[model samples]
Target: MKIVKEALAGTLESSDLMVRVAPSPEGALDVVINSEVMRQFGAQIEKVVRETLERLSVTEGLIVIEDKGALDCAIRARVQTAILRAVENPVLEWSALS
Candidate 1:
């Protein structure tokens, strides 16, 4: 997805990471993160993801992210991208991709 690529190249700061956002037809968003970076900014990542979701207003689905060493900016951007991608296209799987 363009958003994810942009996030990785433009926003992801610490290291390479994988991000996914799956939205249910109901418009609910579920977010998940796992990685070394998470050990540091787990809570912040969740907040950013949730906030992004709230902004997107997706009703339902799972948003999963596999962060290697991405910074908060990276996570935020990726989450935004993933959410958009998920909403636009339904082919992507919303799971922790490593």
Candidate 2:
């Protein structure tokens, strides 16, 4: 799915993460992550983001994540939510993505 516009999901609260996705005309996946645990779990976080995008069949977009110690599942959910919101479709069955 292609991102049509900028969209955001999640919050800044503890144990949560905020994800922002936007369309990229360059046709490249660009991800930027900010987290305190970058020294240890950064690669894992990036991996999850990339995998989620691939699962959604998204090839070009700018994904920005502000992580507040969120778990892997939470990151996936937030990214998915952002992608859905960016697409602006109303009939998508979100549970089916799992």
Candidate 3:
């Protein structure tokens, strides 16, 4: 699914994160991440984001992640929610999301 509009999900509080997504003018995936745990978990967080996007078949978009030490599951859920909202009426494939 392609992102057609700007969308956001999640929060900035401790143990949570915020996900922001938008259509990319560059026609490629652009991801930016800012996290409190960057010193220790940046790579893992990036890995999760990339994998999630790939699973959803999202190849082009701007994804901004603001992390506050959230777990992997929360990150995945937030990314999925932002993508779904950005698509603006997604036809979700339940199996792929798993």
Q: Which segments of model 3 are wrong by more than 4 Å?
A: none
lDDT of 1 by residue, 8-43 (tens): 212334575677554345544556677775667888
Worst 10 residues of 3 by lDDT: 88-97
Residue 55 miss distance in model 3 (angstroms): 0.4
Q: Give the deviation of candidate 2 from the true structure as CA RMSD.
A: 1.7
Local error of candidate 3 at residue 40 (angstroms): 0.4
lDDT value, residue 14 of candidate 3: 98
- For candidate 2, report its TM-score: 0.91
Kindly provide the TM-score of model 1 when superposed on the true structure, using C-alpha atoms.
Answer: 0.61
Q: For this target, which candidate reaches the highest lDDT against the unseen true structure?
A: 3
Predicted candidate 3 versus true structure: per-residue lDDT over 5-95, tens digit per residue: 9999999999999999999998999999999999899999999999999999999999999999999999999999999999967988988
Give the TM-scores of the predictions, in the order they appear.
Answer: 0.61, 0.91, 0.97
Q: Could you give candidate 2's per-residue lDDT for residues 1-98 as a string of tens digits? A: 88999999999998889999999999888999998788899999999989988878889999999998899999999999999899857346555357
Clashing pairs in 1: 24-60, 26-59, 27-58, 27-59, 27-60, 28-59, 28-60, 30-63
Inter-residue clash pairs, candidate 3: none
- Candidates ranked by TM-score: 3, 2, 1
Most accurate candidate by TM-score:
3
